[model samples]
Target: MLARQLEQFSCIRQARVQLAPQSWQSGAVIVLEPARPEAMPDAAALDRMLDTLALIPDAPDKRHVLVFDTEGRRLYPDHETDETARREQEVALERQALRVLRPLLDGNGRAEVLVSLDEAEKGRTTGRRTISVLLEENAVPETVRPHLESLLGQACALEEGRGDALRICFLPARRNAAALRGLALTFAVLALAGMAAFF
Candidate 1:
């Protein structure tokens, strides 16, 4: 089943998906590139869609990403009244989405949100806007480390060159075995010396 699901996802273009299970409910972010500026989805509509998705039995228990072909069509309704209103609504939806996914993110998983305006938008031609949260392995919520690692790999391919990759570096565990061995040897030598002195 997992293999089939992966095969189904193999054909998606310029799409990124992330999963975090340790966060409040489990979180995810999905971004699609080369999006047309005119087709964004409405914030309220997105919120409702996510809420409905959350209720699904197998709906990414934590978090996941769903990308659209364009920033405008992906996020806002076509009939939106004003640019300012549309922008505000987009921001609100992104914030709520992040909040919903926060609990799902673990120390191993990373959560990121990205937006790319139309190619003709001045100053945004070569740049993309992104927000992310990364947690190191075994830091707090250790159980989600493996899933986060896999998700990070997928995210890297999805958002390649868009920005610096988010990572959670693991700290090496401390080892006292050598010190204990030295201490034991010193105690043994001292005992031998004391026995010799008594002879």
Candidate 2:
């Protein structure tokens, strides 16, 4: 099944799929190798692989069907292990989520909202991996908060984390979540890439 998907990418020279389940992980897995000795799946190649995996029945779980490079380095599931990589991937997810979810959140832009991403396995009969979207409190005006939350609940395919929605959290913070965590006692805006990219 995966081999056919790999063949579509001209950049891949070799591909391998393994079911090496760890105590922390359960079910199937995908371990990829580079096309050339020095090459790895770029963004386009990655989307090709993940998109195929998405078509499989009962396959919204990204944790099991993950992407890794030739060196056995995680590409898709890179968040928990690498801090810098985590920020990049997590922020990327957050930024994109905000871009899609922002317009839906009315009376926002009073202050910047910092989003954090995490993953978990949920379900009673058949468990599945779910993306956890955590939003700092005050993301929207107090009046709009409930609506924003309800709208996002409808966005995800399943209700794993919300009372029914995928795992969405409203982080309670004393100050701006980004600045508070980025540099304590420092009032600075650590704009990633550009604020425009998110807005």
Candidate 3:
């Protein structure tokens, strides 16, 4: 039943609509916005979208990078409280969202996550938080790109005040296991050589 719903949601014709499970709400909802023709999504919406997407069922071999627009309302909604309180809230939300999504974005899913705030609002916001995830490119199979993209797009749309000029990107996961193994072997050999010299 869930699989069929997911498929139907993915087939939605609008380019900017997205669907995903919401961690806070514990329910799936549809987010709608204009196509990528207007302004980009805000920081608050981006954060909410990531929070929602963390609940998706991802494969172990697929890698993903969830980009959040930190300058928009997608991640941090403007509040009347003092700047300190608002900033603290934003940071807390980002940390919690990352903790939940980290496992799904790592390894054969060499996910590279990034949260980018618009340059104009870089230091102006009351609550400021920056989070990034870096993983090898090409982690997930090409077949999954459409599905993931659809999910992300839907997530962006479901939020409040998401614009059409949004620019969300997903990179392919890269393989670096061989490079890591080589480095480990080199370190082991060096340690053994040093021991022999000391004796």
Over the stretch 4-116, how does candidate 2's per-residue lDDT look in tens digits? Answer: 56656777766665442232244344556666765776555576567776666644444445566655466765445532343345334434546656775434432232333
Q: Candidate order by TM-score, highest to lowest?
A: 2, 3, 1
Candidate 1 accuracy as TM-score: 0.25
lDDT, candidate 1, 1-199, per-residue tens: 2122322332323444444223213434444332333433345644444454454555553223333342423442323443324333434444543454467654344444432222223554333323343333334366665575455345333245555343444554333589989999999999999999999
Regions more than 4 Å wrong, model 1: 1-15, 32-35, 51-56, 60-199
Q: How far is candidate 3 from the true structure (C-alpha RMSD, Å)?
A: 17.1
Whichever of 1 and 3 has more lDDT, that candidate is 1
lDDT comparing candidate 3 with the true structure: 0.38
- Using all chains and alpha carbons, the TM-scores for the candidates as numbered come to 0.25, 0.33, 0.28
**Best lDDT among the predictions, by candidate number:** 2
Q: Mind giving the per-residue lDDT tens digits that candidate 3 earns over 1-199? A: 2223222333222322122212112322223332342444454544443454445565111112122233222323333434324333433443444454454453546443333222224444321223344434454445654455344334322232322222335554443689989999999999999999999
- The per-model lDDT (C-alpha) reads 0.42, 0.51, 0.38
Off by over 4 Å in 2: 20-26, 43-48, 57-60, 81-199
Ranking by lDDT: 2, 1, 3
- For model 2 the local lDDT of residue 102 reads 72
RMSD of each: 16.2, 16.0, 17.1
1 versus 2: better TM-score goes to = 2
Clashes of 3: 37
